[model samples]
Target: MDKIIRIGTRSSKLALWQANTVAEQLGHFGHKTEIVKIDSIGDIVLDKPLYELGITGVFTKNLDIALLNGEIDIAVHSFKDVPTKLPEGIVQAAVLKRGDFNDVLVIKEDENFFTKDAAIIATGSLRRKAQWLYRYPHHTITGLRGNVITRLQKLEDNDWDGAIFAAAGLKRLKLLPEKEKHIKLDWMIPAPAQGAVMIAALEKDEDILEACKEINHEETATCVGIERDFLRVLEGGCTAPIGALAMIFDEEIKFKGTLFSPDGKNKMEFYKEVPVNNATDLGEYGANYILERGGKKLMREVHDIEKSTLVYSTKSLSHDQTNNLSSKIGVTSSDFITIRNNRLKRVIVKKPIKNALFTSQNAVEALLNNFSRVELDFENIYCVGRRTKRLIEKKIGKVTHIENNSEKLADYLVKNLDTKEVTFFCGDKRMDDLPTTLLNNYFIVNEVECYQTQLTPRLIEDKYKGILFYSPSGVESYLKENTANEIVAFCIGETTAKKAKDHFKNVVVSKLSTVESVIKSVNDYFQE
Candidate 1:
């Protein structure tokens, strides 16, 4: 084919490097190429983590659309980002020569942090986070997103001890330091197709397909195929932390795979080998082995964890603000009603408040504002959410049993707590079910209000395509000034969604109940 092939690619530095490299390879075979730079939704939205976006091909979807629409002849992408199931009419044309598959820890020039319990590691990938946490349970993992260069910059600018990055990406961009500033994390199993570049084109475009086939690396393609098959068979979508690596050596195929819990406390791993002739069945067999060895249960737990973490905020958030908040939380968003806290003049604890329970940061903030260490006495502090824990830590310098919700914290207390009595510092609008549930379980509960939530309904004269609600009161507040008959309502969780369904015709509930999840719900609905 003498016609010039158009290669669609992301405009990121790493993406451009991959595209240009592919174009140069194609040029070697006497095929003329044109590089077409395009921006993907994943690139445009930097506020949320990739998995929380709740889309499979967040990075490749734009290129897939371009290929289908004839805007480009072929699309170049990092194979790991491409969904196993390609969009209709598009298929993988070529798998380029594989590169370094190991993840690398890029640390600051002066920092010597490694495997330290007190060190913080920043990485946007769930696979990296789960594995790292599983190995170093004491180390903290925070979210870091952006292109390779931006991520590197973030590592330098932020106070984090280190950040995780792909070895292939750094090598491709020539960003790897000459010194020993980066350490290869060989302990981690690479995500499927991690170090390979995939070229995709219309399945029916025989000319382009034939041209691409000439440049395809058969060995890399075979190994990645096996790895992807394992991924598909396990059904480990973006929501779960999964890793797979396949290699060919001495005319035989070797595979290693792993599935991890969200918190990284539990995991299942598999290692297998087979003759070259039996490579086609290796992935399925390995997946079956893992599934039999508790992978099935791990997958279910991951799904449950993804759905159970709810972010129920009382503040009204716009879409952009919601996205920004989700980025900060390193997850999704779910906002609800408005909150108003009382100014505590003093926290007068006449007697000892044995075990103190806090439901929200508002209560902790109120307490800290009113009382110094001398004014309060408590044996231990337990809180519901991250915000509450941070606030309590700021004042009391310690917190325990930090759960995502009141129910989970209550369950934890009932199962292991030795304390006979507890004092709950909460808001005026706090629900009574948590205390009642504890009371029925034989634990003495004393409740004190430190803050209040006021429902302030604004006149939404302009109709919106969707309304986001984080709490039951938020739903009520939203409905006080508007109708939900024609609009879609995105709720944070089952409870909030249940309340939203009472008035809205079309309701979508975020499984994770985070602001990012709510925004993802909105995008998912509109994109559908």
Candidate 2:
């Protein structure tokens, strides 16, 4: 009896179809297969943009986790969602035959919207958004996220003129609408591996590798490999408006790639055809062609729309996350800091702790991931910032003490705390102000480093009226690559404001220490 090969995939219809196709392909080679459904962060998170989340291969992360843990023998994935670089222990098993590699715009009605001066288009992709804006500068671009079925339904449901989607996904799922309803964006370059399905498996699985090799399409693999190699050089742990497509002719492979600013006003493009014999290093060669020119500078300068009242945030935020901001003003953000829970630190938290101190929302979230709200409902819950307090109140219990900054929180704790000792949960990069003050006051403080924060500063290519900042570290990160001397700084609190005042011309601290307060400060400052 043959051992059943387990295929892992997202529970979505497209993913299921891909998995079944792989299973059937494997079965053809005298191998039995089983489909294993796995949940991915990309599928669960519909609110945040993929790039802003600071996660590489958001769609493949969970699947990779599952694969690493031996939950499945193989994982079928949309190749484009997989990062250019594979995880260390995982290797690509096969690339299926290519499909129609073009983006389609599912329109609401007639083509009249295209001829109009201002139209509304929706897409979740940064590449699609930039290309569309380049072609139609006057058009408004809204975010649309979900599976193929959900997106098609959204196109019909929303008042927008159209929404962009992959033609291959629609065709694969049989979700493509009538010919009159959708238009193929022939001019736009598709993402690397856009229409390809890839099978990934553990590096040491010899039997799985041999089984998958039977289904691999050499031509498809070659084309996508070059395209992915191009992407690997250009995108280094960051997302950008980048697009590439590679085609194999009889004797030669032709490739075209373009990089654009976030708003698509500035672009760098390159096209090259290399003989099939010498095409192994074509991707790296072509990418260098763009980088040596203006591509490097252009990547750094992708700016916000200048004419509009745009505010750039150092942290990634969805429009819904900030209900306080008006629709008239455009808000674009990319996270400058990445935070993750520390697994080792989580273990240090024991039950029935009398008192707790949280400096940031990340710390609270990290601690809660290990200990539930009921278990963490201490006699006294002390935290800094209103948002942190709000989260505690909603999830855990009441906040006995809250302040805008660690300095203030420490001050409050010094005078009011009847308990001689407290456990403080914080990130690795947390400021030492509070800890220093506590120890100096002779208070016994047990600190648990629950999370870690890393700065990932990016260039702000376009001019904005103001920039919103949530942390002093964010300000430091932004200054590493770019400057905002002429613009106003909208800071979440006084500590962040202090950092901004050193760089920005006008620094406005929020009346209260919260994301909403910072937005309100922006509106109020403009109103005044």
Candidate 3:
């Protein structure tokens, strides 16, 4: 005599597909299965916006109630739709394998679609609305509520130019018409946990839970766990217009995240990949990295503007200094401060400077502050990367040359420099590559100690499942004073990877030098 497992799901075509998928998996374990379709608040209420409802559980409330009342044994939910905090007596039993997590743009084939201004799009989510508005505010987004079939039908009926939907949903339903193509990752990011199904069960149902475990996909579970953790830390809801998607492929896990203003006029995105072994810490680490880098300030400004027009600008000053300057100039500026305090130097210049090279904006700002009085009639100015080039151009009017990295800059100087005389303006603690490489080419490159970047004495006091290191300096600083309690280390670039190996031998190096690569590496490490 086997127990019958009642799978609860929303009464939508897509939800049925998810429910059926779960039931089929359970059936393999010799369990009798049945599906109980229930309508959620999100399904019934069509008139009002999600934010105005002021209630939290529009997507899960109905199914949850049914689960608690014993009408259903388990509830199948789109992982993204589930709230961070679970209700009493319910726990996430398992997560099935994830599908394509990218958002797809279904554009109608019409000659008039070439212009961006007159395009009309359809979407049901505020998250989608915010992102779309951020990127294409001129293109209007009409609310299209219904399951996948109904929404697509409305799009065809109204002759709406296009609609944005989760790639996973369309693929799961097998309803992507031949006329449309899947959107590329460069176009849009998907909702957090968008592709995965979360199985919710009564806390006491150990037997059914054990049976449900057979369907659980370890890689999908790990990646979604990290993505959900990011959403939790951001304090974002379905209406926040924040999107995050994680993928575990090869030996790495990649996380792509975005934040959009409420009206969708402004948006900031970040990507990180690390070994799968560090997937547990990927979300928090990735979120923190984005916040520390620039996303936090962008998010704050977006949140502050609400419906007002936003003007974005960048000035060389500390947050306090910027505030003082803005106040003096009769402009109300939102604090768009990043980790400025950690990575800049204060100095006074006395001698005439000849050659200057900048790797980071912080380095450029610090150099500018020192030479504010002196006219920099340099032989040549070398800048690393596009960001440093912009900073240099803003302050110095123009730059002599730009290279992709410090290594490339060194290579350029080695090939072209006939006279072995160049001074490098740099941080107090910097990589030896630029100097060492130049020296190998018989060029005299003086390394000036401009500023020092040190880690905070108090590291974030959370029990992270893994740790991420962006730079060799960060790794050295972190390891010099503090212990990470046996957390797996995910390193960004080669330098950071070397530093991690020096301390923790089993360091995970990202396939790419970017943040997205580090996140992907973390995903793959954990899945293994």
lDDT of 2 by residue, 1-528 (tens): 278999999998889989999999888889999999988433342234434432256688788777777888999998988877677678999999999999999889889987788899999898899899998899999998887788778888889999999999999888888999899999999998899999999899989998999999999999999888888767622368888898989889999988888897887888998887678977766676676555666674433233347778887553244446764466666778888887753346445667888988898888777777655647788988778899989888888888878888888889988777888888887654888899999989888888888889778766578889998888888899987768888998877887788888889998888778888888788766
In order of appearance, the predictions have TM-scores of 0.55, 0.55, 0.54
Off by over 4 Å in 2: 40-56, 236-238, 300-528
lDDT of 3: 0.68
TM-score of 2: 0.55
Over 1-528, each residue of candidate 1 has an lDDT whose tens digit, in order, gives: 799999999988889999999999999999999999977433243334434532246788678766766888999999998887776667899999999999998877545565344888899988899999998888899999988888989988988988999999999889997557888899999999999999999889999999999999999999999898888777786767889999999988889988998778898888888887768867766776676445767773433233212332335343244444322132222223555666664434766677899876667877766677767887788887665677777678688678766677888888878876888888776653678878989999887787777777655534345677766778887677766667677776665777778888888987564566766776666655
Q: What is the lDDT of residue 363 in candidate 1?
A: 78
Checking candidate 2 for backbone clashes, the offending pairs are 301-461, 303-462
Residue 162 of model 3 has an lDDT of 82
Task: Give the lDDT of residue 279 in candidate 3.
Answer: 68
Model 3 CA deviation exceeding 4 Å by range: 40-55, 133-137, 179-186, 292-528
On a 0 to 100 scale, what is the lDDT of residue 167 in model 3? Answer: 78
Q: Number of the top candidate by lDDT?
A: 2
Q: How high is the lDDT of residue 368 in model 3? A: 60
- The lDDT per prediction is 0.77, 0.82, 0.68
lDDT of 1 at 518: 67
